[model samples]
Each structure stands twice: as C-alpha cells, then as structure tokens.
Target: ILGLLDDSPECRAFKQQLADLSLIYGKRGERGTLVTKTVNPAPLLETLQYYFRQPADFLEKQIHLWETERNERLQSVRKTLQDYPQDVVEKFERHLKMTENANQLRELNNEWLDVPIMNYFRRLVQEFARRLTESKVLEKTIDVYHLTADELQEATAMLPEVMEVRQRVHERQVEEEKFANVTPPAFMGAYPVDAVYTLDPLTLSYLNTEAPNPVDVPGGLGAVPASPGKVIGRAKVLRCTTAIN
Candidate 1:
C-alpha cells in the first residue's frame, strides 16, 4: 500500500519493516491475521478502477503533444545545419569521421559506453547557430524571408559565433592526433633542470624567499604551504598527471 503511494527510500524501508513485523507474527502463530479489519482495500480498488476508466482521448492528446514537440526540435536542428558554410561543413564532416572512429574503438575494446553523440551533434548545431549569429546571417536571412526583427534577434541569439564553430570542429582533429604520435619524454640526461622547472629561475628564487623559511617549491618533489595555519602529519604524495587511463 505504501509502495503504491510512493517508491521513495523511506516508504521502501517502511514496507520492509511491515514484512519483518509479519514474519514476527507468523512465528508467534498469528500469521493469518495480524491486525483484524485494519486493511481497507478501497484505495487499491479505486486506483485500478481509475486506470481502467482512463479516457481513450487522453493517450491521443499526449501522443500528439509529444509528436509536435519532437517535430519542432528536429526542424530547429535542420535549420541550424542548413546555415553551415562550406568550410564549416567540411570541418564538421571531419569531426563526424573522428567520432565514428572513437565509437568503433569502443566497440572493438568491448567497452560499455554512454558517449551522448547526439549532444555532440547538438553542440555542432549550436556552433553553426553561433556562427550565424556572429555573422548576422540569421538576422539577414530572417530579414530576407520577411521575418520580424524581434524574431530574427531571438533566432540569432540562439546560434554560435563563426570562430567558435571552427574551433569546435578543429578540437576533434586535435584529439584524434593526441594518441597517434605519443612518445615518452627522454629521461637519459640529468633531468634537464631547465625543462624540469619551466618557470624562470628569478621567479622561483623570488617565491622561495617570500616565506620566512625555505618553503618547499610548488610543482616540485615537495609541498608548499597551501594555507596559513600549520599542523603536523605524514606528507602524502599527490600526483598530478594528465595521462588518460
């Protein structure tokens, strides 16, 4: 009865408690009836009756609403895609190819994934919109189509800028090349001090003297004071690596 009303954790816990109580009753030879005449089956009966009596038109109205919303979303996506320039289109095609390759790699590795490819497609659409907005293409196109100035403004704001669109497409290409020419850093020489500490030596020396005592350098083998107050504890190494698992 509680489960029918709500499937929340508290309700579920209460139901379990009822089951335990029933078990206790059963052990005490009171299994048949724990609480005489306490159960009123009217709510259950009413729920079942209500479900059976639901109007047929209700489902039709819901279906129609869903279909209308879906069509609108599809139309919006199509309109955004149609506005893409030739260069943008070529970049988008390359991104699509990279995405397909990534999906294939996942499949080959037998990895269960939830990569929301539709989201990437939507982002592309947004980039196209932004480009249209920045170029005032949407505004001009709307004007050419005799759409109201207000409508054009609204439409244009919903789209992406041209540079943003190009960057999004280029990002996919960059990611694809990331693993292609991967090489481990050469560890042959005495840790090439200059490369090991990319910061200017003057900058490092200045930071070191800023504190009263010789502070352990940040981004090195030791920790610098991150906060004002001090406490004693065994130092734990915190690794900051960018390697993808």
Candidate 2:
C-alpha cells in the first residue's frame, strides 16, 4: 500500500522506490525475474501527451524567443547580400568555375541569382549572334572557284603576299584608332581612362591562368595583387564588411 506524505526527503525516496517497483513489474512477471512482454505506443498520442504535460506559459515563452532570434538572423543575412551584390557575384563566379558543369549551370541559372540579370545576358548573346549573321562575318562558304592543278599552284604562290598585306593593313588601322583617342587625363583630374590591370588569384585562377604564388602574411596566404603598387609594410586583406571587426 502507498501512503500519502508531504514533500519531504523521506516522501521523495518513497516515490522513487514506487517508480522502481512499477518499472520492474512492468518489465517482468509478478515473481519471475526475466519475464519479457512488448508494449506498442501510438506516436501521435505519445507526442500529444508529452506536449500537454509541459507548462503552457513556459512553452509560449520559448517559442517567442526562438522566433525572435530566427528573424534577427534572417534580417542580418539579407542586409549583407544587399550591401555586397557585386562582391557576392564575383565570389559566386569563382565558385562556379570550380564546381559548375553543363547541367549545373542550367540549375544555377534557373534557381539562383536575379532572374532579370540572367535574362538580360541571354538576350545580349542572342543579339550578338543575330548581328553576326546579318553582317555575314562568320559565314560558312563553299568555294565554287574549283581550280585545276596548275591554277592551284599559281594561286598558292600569290597567297603568302596577299595575307602579309592584309595583316599590315589591320595593324595600321588599330594604331590609327589608338592615337585618335583624346589626350590622357592629369593625375588629379576626373576623366575616363582605360587602364589594364591584373586580377586577383580568385579571378585570375578561375580564368585558367598560372597565377603568381601568394605572399605569406599574418592571417593567411595573401590573395594575388589586383593592381600593382608599392607599400612599405604589411597589408591587411579585407574582403567583407564583417572582417572589419
């Protein structure tokens, strides 16, 4: 028989004993030490009972705290992407070069990045092809001027000189355009300038170049220089806003 008692050490000890006895009886026969019987529980009912036993106010407080934390984290990530779209795109392009294949590019183009930007690039390529077709710039031509063996020998002899003149004319035209451009801007002035510069390892290596070995520095191996400049001491690489902290 179980006796009712106040919440004391003796009472707690008695309750523990009762629990141990119940478990023992539930597992084995009344007298046998190793009786085995199986008990099946309904998952939905068990879950409902477990939740119902929890204090409502405590559960509500926990849920509210979890929701607040999740929303704050989502907002932080959104702000980061918004503030660094181009940097994100460049990083993504680098990552793509490593992992992308024909099928992967199709998946990424359909599922990731802004849809409008992808559409614009597709339209641009289509327009370029159309223009080339209209101009007959990359046309496939079947030579209708089939020549005899003697005539072929004669044409071959003249081919080298004709090709040499064409190349010289092309080079002359390029030089003319270079000189015709406006004067170079002063150091302090704001003017449009075209300067050629090397890309960092992240971009250069992605483009399949044998990039220069990175300099050993404090944090890690430094990224290859994007532009050439001399500095006296060590330089810190800051790729993201969070790195400032």
Number of the predicted model whose lDDT against the real structure is largest = 2
Q: How does residue 36 of candidate 2 score in lDDT?
A: 33
Q: Which sections of candidate 1 miss by over 4 Å?
A: 1-53, 86-245
**Minimal lDDT window, size 10, model 1:** 28-37
Q: Could you give candidate 2's per-residue lDDT for residues 1-245 as a string of tens digits?
A: 23342367897686666566545432322122222332222343468668888897978899899999978985776566554546554565556456545223443332233443444454554554344334443121111022233433443455433212233335555776788896865676665454435575555654668766555579766655563544344345788999997
TM for every model, in the order presented, reads 0.19, 0.21
Candidate 2 vs. truth: CA RMSD?
28.6
lDDT computed for candidate 1: 0.48
Off by over 4 Å in 2: 1-10, 18-56, 83-236, 239-243
For all candidates, the clash counts are 8, 0
Error of 1 at 107 (Å): 21
lDDT of 1 by residue, 54-141 (tens): 8978778889999999789857755765665555445555655665575443332221112233334445555545556458554322
| Per-residue lDDT of 193 in model 2 | 53
